[model samples]
Target: MTASPPAHDPEPPARRRGRPPRTESAGTRDRILAAAREEFSARGYEKTSVRGIAKAAGVDSALVHHYFGTKEQVFEAAIEVAFAPALNAPEAVAEGSPDAVGERLTRFVLGIWENPTTRTPLLAIVRSAVNNDTAAAVFRRLVAAQLLRRIAAQLELPDAELRAELAAAQLVGCAMLRYVIKVEPLASADLEQIIARVAPVVQGHLTAP
Candidate 1:
């Protein structure tokens, strides 16, 4: 009857051209996160903004908000990505000889900081955490939920949580001084030398008699 009303209206070219490729995809979300990291690294938490992140990412500000919700949420996401490798530290403990778990854990974490790709994002995250309360909260949650608690589980010891925190403090302090503060000797020191010295303290924290 009227050619069945042409079945359906032709899709609008403008709408099709401007539409997001999909509702959400890993690739787009990652790009937003990577851009946010660069922005935070360059500007710090207090100075960085969603519009800047979106611009750096070549997307609308709305897209950044769509993917990450808010600037604090974006920081959390970025921290999560940067620390993803370090989260596997529990495995380093689980797979190693009980006595040597400290070195395994230390080596695993320092190795992440040693890589330029991972370190850049970490620098941004740590700097943000130091300067912003919200960033610090995000960092703490990510560390506690994804890393320290799991390592504690593997210890099977009293005060496992405290042990995990102490071990974390040892490694994290070293990382901050070497990577972020750039203290001369520590910054210039060889990775193995640092690990060799720090690993024992980490071991004591986790498994001292």
Candidate 2:
């Protein structure tokens, strides 16, 4: 038998294994997420692609699909990264009186975008939503599923759901105009001034008759 092919030379060290060493799957997932965020932010949701994200992330397109399954899933992940900190706003709002809830909510929401750490992602989401319907749908789902419903649950009003949704729309709209679209005067105005003018309106939507 030809000496059994020289006894296979003990299969050698490199060829002994059937597959490469397993890596930390979570690391790859996180890297994909980071890359997705950058791609989405830079190209917007409509223009971003799995291949582009994978190339930017230094991975295979199959890897992005393996981690997120679909472009929508990737968008959802990016939104989560963008909105994670703001997720705590409902809890903060729950701690205060109904009368003060509007101001508190305003401050909390606006404060997030005012900070550079949070502002970048928030602006990215805003810009993408404005330019792409797919991004807008994702944003709506996020606000409805996380922010609006949670805050509505804390309210004792009859029209809590509608009111909460309206408030969310107002907040998001203001952010779009002031920050994303950069509408003059509103965009250049001080944070405190905008809060003072808009908080009462939001509060009214929530607590008014």
Index of the highest-lDDT prediction = 1
- TM match of model 1 to true structure: 0.86
Summarize candidate 1's per-residue lDDT along 116-197 as a digit string, tens digits. 8988888887888889898888888888888899999989999999999999899889999898888999999999999999
After superposition, the stretches of candidate 2 with alpha carbons farther than 4 Å from their true spots are 1-24, 131-133
Across residues 40-136, which tens digit of lDDT does each residue of candidate 2 receive? 8788888899889878877667666655878988988989988998899889789968798898888899888778778877777877888888889
How far off is residue 12 in model 1, in Å? Answer: 14
Candidate 1: residue pairs that collide: none
What is the TM-score of each predicted model, taking all chains together?
0.86, 0.81
Model 2 sits at a Cα RMSD from the real structure of 8.3
